[model samples]
Target: MLQVQGVFKSYATPQGPLAVLQGVDLHLEHGSSLALMGESGSGKSTLLHLMAGLDQVDRGTISIAGQRLDQMNEARLANWRRTDIGLVFQQFNLISSLKIDDNLAFQARLAGRFDPLWQAQLIERLGLGDLLKRYPEQLSGGQQQRVAVGRALASKPGLLLADEPTGNLDEATSDEVLQLLLDLLRDSATSLLMVTHSTRVAERLAHKVVLQNGRVADAGER
Candidate 1:
């Protein structure tokens, strides 16, 4: 469902360009899950951004579900992001003013692909049914994060790109929510590429990939 090859990205600093991802290669099949692990300065999140088309690659090709993102212009990329990619950030980028239901369906509505039935189901499954009318700030950190998660999956995009989805939740909440996410993704036939710091969480995924020094240190077999 996804393929990335020979990706090289860099950022400029006072000294010169600081390289983050170099000659990175990745492949993921349909409905499969991949866990990416690495240290603070590693290129895990950078790769995720590239895959989601949130950032441009200096040199590489990113193809998700047979659509090559590297060839898209800004407007096309935005459209692709809205229609094909679902992203979960560590910051849980939920709209502060929008209520739960609206937030969940925001992207879907924008893309003219809103599935009201699926949205309602996601709200209930994420335990946000009772808080549908409430804004994001009205909830606790965990609740907000779950809402963010619901928002991402609500769009029913083919590829799910998550960066530290459980980063802010408690251990128990993390496990519970992740299980829900996994079960939902499995049932919905969505592919996942997640970046995480915990091996315990990584092990739960079908494939584990380690990103070290801008390269693959170890990759688990399918």
Candidate 2:
């Protein structure tokens, strides 16, 4: 459902242009999950950002569910992001003022894919049924991350892009969140491309791809 071919990206620095991703090629089939593993500055997050169309590539192509992301303008990319992708960040980017229920339903409402039944189910499944009236500041890190996952899935998006989804939680809590996320993905055709530093966490996915110095160094079943 997602494909990246020969993607090259770089950024400007004092010295010169610093390459972040060089000829990175990867693919994930429908409903399949893949872990993107790499050390700091290995370009894992850069690749994910390219896939999400948050940044432009210097060269090559990125296609998600047959849509040419490289060809889209800013407005079109924003629309695609809203309609076709569900993103989870390490910071649990929830609105400080919005209550849990509104935060969970925010993206779905914007994407015009809101379903009360599905939203309710997600809240219950993520163990947020009772916390719906609470604000982000009122919850723990794990609870906040659960709400983030719920918000992402609430849109019922075709593909999920997560950047260290469990980064801020404790190990045990991270495991819990990952399991709940996997269970939720199993119920739909949504594919996952998650960037993680933990090999153990990467092993939980069906496939793994290691990035080294902006290139895809290894890709194999996990």
Candidate 3:
């Protein structure tokens, strides 16, 4: 459902241009999950951002569900991102002012794809029903992240892009959250592309690809 070909990205430094990703190629099939592994400067997050259309790639093509992200104007990309991409960052990114219920429905409302039944199922499955009346600050880290996941999936996006989604939680909590995420993805048939540093996390996905020297060093099924 996603493809990246010969993608190159660089940023200007005081001395010169520093290339982060060079000629990177990768693909993820529909209803599959892929884990992206790399060291701190290996461009894992850059690749994820390109696929999400949050930033334009300096060169190469990124296509999601047959649409090329590099070719779209900002307006079109914004609209596409809202409807087709679900993003979960390391930080929960929940609205502090809004209660859990409002935060859960935020994205779905924006995308005009809100479904009460689907949301009800999400709340039940994520064990978030009891937290609906609480604000973000009032909940624990795991609870907040669960709310974040619920918000991201509320719209039923075709793809889910996660960046160190479990970074803040403890090992047990991380595993719990990851299992819940994988289960939800399976139910909706949504493709997943997650950037993580943990091998244990990587092993849980269907495929794993390691980045080295700005290129995909190897990719294989787990």
After superposition, the stretches of candidate 3 with alpha carbons farther than 4 Å from their true spots are: none
What would the C-alpha RMSD of candidate 2 be, to one decimal place? 0.7
Q: Which candidate has the highest lDDT of all?
A: 3
lDDT of 2 by residue, 161-197 (tens): 9999999999999999999999999996799999999
RMSD of 1: 1.1
Quality of model 1 by C-alpha lDDT: 0.88
Error of 2 at 55 (Å): 0.4
In terms of TM-score, how similar is model 1 to the real structure? 0.96
Q: What is the lDDT of residue 173 in candidate 1?
A: 85
Q: Which scores higher on lDDT, 1 or 2?
A: 2
Go through the candidates in order and give each one's C-alpha lDDT: 0.88, 0.94, 0.95
Q: For model 1, what is the alpha-carbon lDDT of residue 82?
A: 88
The model with the greater lDDT, 2 or 3, is 3
Models, CA RMSD each: 1.1, 0.7, 0.6
Tens digit per residue, CA lDDT, model 3, 1-222: 999999999999999999999999999999999999999999999889889898888889999999998779999999998999999998999999999999999999999999999999999999998899999999999999999999999999999999999999999999999999999999999999999999999999999999998999988896
Model 2 spans > 4 angstroms off: none
Worst 10 residues of 3 by lDDT: 50-59
